[model samples]
Target: MKVGVVTFPGSLDDVDAQRAVRLGGHEAVALWHGDHNLQGVDAVVLPGGFSYGDYLRCGAISRFSPVMTEVVEAAGRGMPVLGICNGFQILCESHLLPGALVRNQRQKFLCLDQRLRIERTDTPWTAAYAEGQEVVIALKNGEGSFVADTETLDRLEGEGQVVARYLGENPNGSLRDIAGVSNERGNVVGLMPHPEHSVEELCGTGTDGLGFFALATLAAEVFA
Candidate 1:
């Protein structure tokens, strides 16, 4: 399996994400935000950080990155794409996922190892977990609150698009405590937590997040 991790300016987690992919037994390809090619990777990961220094808005500038055009097109064709943190914001900005991530309701950056419940394991990025499984991963960001119109929220819940929900407490006041979501096709997913950071147990967060990368590789195998 070959996984591409995009690095945008200020992207702090791209290297970590690539390491996670490599640890998951996949080839980790470094991708540039300015590149138009995906380098024939099997899947893509949008790592976290304050891209473009979070100017204008989190992920606003990154949504227009040259790579995003390919990402959007590939995702439309069922290529699995996982967007983490600021990447999640980009997914929403690109309309790859529903809802917008706003400033934390508390108006502060949050950093913690948060517990999350797997709500939709059928997506390509989450198939390694059973529904209702509990896993803890690192979460950190300044703008991580998820918001959408009432109808959109209801639709997401109704359509089973809610991929993961905060387990202990809502850290950012995300609606329904949503920590992650998948597109209707289930190929594209965006999550607020930093799964790439938790894939190494020596780092102390456990290997729970390893499943995310593993599952994407597995899905590629299954569909190949």
Candidate 2:
């Protein structure tokens, strides 16, 4: 399987996401934010960073990038799309996922090894994880709090769209401690934590995050 890792201006973890893809036994394709083409990749990953300098808001400017046009279309076709950190914000801004990412309750940037419980394993990116399993990953962000209306939150929870939740203390004060979520089709996922940074034991928190990339390989076969 070939996974495209998009590199937007100010993307800090695009290369790390590419490395994770390779370590998961798949090819990684470099994608440019300014390109409207997807280059025929099987899946797409929007890595973490302060895109467009977080100008108006986190991910506000980058959501209008040329590459996101292709990404939104591909995701609509059931192509697996994973967004991390600032990428998560982009997904929300693009309306690919529900809710909005707001500033932390304490109004401060946070960096830590966050423990998240795998809530839904049916998504293409989470199939390798067991339900209720806990995994630690690197998390760093200022506006990571997930907010949604009560009805929407209830609908997401009722439909099993909530993918992961913070296990310990809520680092960013996300509503319901949501660390991740998936679209109705389960192909598009937005996660606040940096799973790419956790794929290598020597570098990040641990290798627990490798499951996300590993399971994505099967999505190509399933969707093909």
Candidate 3:
């Protein structure tokens, strides 16, 4: 399967994401933020970065990128889309996912190896993980706290839309310790951690993050 990784002007992790895709046994297709084509990739990944210099709020400007136009359409048609860190913010800004990522409770930028518990495995991005499985991945962000209305929060919990949660201490004060979430159809996922950074054991970050990308092949088959 070919996974497309979009690169915005301020994108910092697109190259790492492409490498992770290859290590996960898939071809990585580079897509430009200014392009409207998806290049017929099986899935898409919105890598983390301070797009548009994080002006007007994180992900607020990047959501209007030309590539996102295609991404939003593809996601609607059941194509799998994974958003990481700032990418998660873009997903919310684009209305592809519910809730908002606000500044952390401490109001400071955080960077650490975060422990997260897999809450659901039905989504394409998480199918390789077991429910309740715990994994440590790189997490870095100043605005990573997830917030939603009480009713929406209840609905997400009841429907199992919450994909992952912080295991130990809540690093960014995300509500309910939520670390990741998925759309209603489970094809779109937005995670606050950087799975791409933890794919190689040589990096001493462990291989837990690889599972997030390893399952990309199954997405085309299962979601089709």
Model 3 residue 97 CA deviation in Å:
0.3
Estimate, for each residue in 19-125, the C-alpha lDDT of model 1 and write its tens digit.
Answer: 99988888899999999999998899999999999999899999999999999999998989999999999999999999999999999899998999999998878
Candidate 2 residue 187 Cα shift, in angstroms, is: 0.2
Scanning candidate 3 in windows of ten residues, the lowest lDDT window is 214-223
- Relative to the unseen true structure, what is the Cα RMSD of model 1? 1.3
lDDT of each: 0.92, 0.93, 0.92
Question: Can you write out model 3's per-residue Cα lDDT over 105-224, one digit (the tens) per residue?
Answer: 999999998889999899888998989999999999999999999998999999999999998888988998999999999989999999999998898368889999986447558568
Better of 1 and 2 by lDDT: 2
Candidate 3 to truth, TM: 0.97
Question: Candidate 1 has what TM-score?
Answer: 0.97
Count clashing pairs, candidate 2: 0
Those runs of model 1 whose alpha carbons end farther than 4 Å from true positions after fitting are: 216-224
Candidate 2 residue lDDT tens string, 1-114: 889999999999999999999998889999999999999998999999989988999899999999999999999999999999999999999999999999999999999999
